[model samples]
Target: MKTSLAVASATVALAVLFPFAAAEAQQAKPQSWPGIKRTDLQRHDLSAPGREVIQVHVDFAPGAAVPAHSHPGEEIVYAIEGAMEYQVEGQSPVTLKSGDVLFIPAGAIHSVKNAGSGNAAELATYIVEKGKPLLVGK
Candidate 1:
């Protein structure tokens, strides 16, 4: 299942998760995710004063791979299309297809590659510190 990139507004839970809607604009900077297309969505402040939450849409080209990297904060990925072979530090690779959800702790080294012939997509949610970059290249 190849799902196109869909942009939706925030929800209550998402708002709660990412509370800084007031500073939504100009916060989500586009990222260069090798072999992938990334659409950065709204970024909001978390209930915690200095923390923030950001959401993004990522599409992996067939056989594409995202280089090993780490997030400054927690990352939650929900597979929306096709399948992906995902690996994290100290963990075996896992195949995540539609409906699969994976969580990566902050600073964990990881990478992902499309495991299917078609494209793959996922929703990535990040809970990070305010003004900090979301991803850190390893």
Candidate 2:
């Protein structure tokens, strides 16, 4: 997939695992994310009409990856454990470690891989349109 992190990076100022995964979570079902584990900690409807923010916690097995995907919201990521290789379409891959931050724009295709010997985890905050799906697998 083209590394398109630039738009997402710029937009955070922008955009998870799959459409069904998000759908399942929304329905309060157990969510299964390929190559990773996730928890939607909270969803806050913004005061701005039609906007909302979601907090997600994710963990990837060492060397595991979430395939190319896009979202309908801007994602801001903060690394929590180990390291991750984040690539957005048309952009150079960025290695994010604990305490590092990244921005992803809505609808920008991207992929993330664990880049360390141990599992990697991150916190993602998404600002998105109300009622829109969180992820779309490519």
lDDT string, candidate 1, 58-99, tens digits: 999897888787877899999999999999999999999999
* Cα lDDT, model 2, residue 20: 46
Candidate 1 versus the native: TM-score?
0.75
Expressed as tens digits, the lDDT of each residue in 19-114 for candidate 2 is 544564654322444558887677779998999899989989877888788877899999998999999998999999999999998989998999
Give lDDT per model, in order. 0.80, 0.81
Report how far off residue 94 is in candidate 2 (Å). Answer: 0.3
Per model, how many backbone clashes are there?
3, 17
User: Of the candidates shown, which would achieve the greatest lDDT relative to the real structure?
Assistant: 2
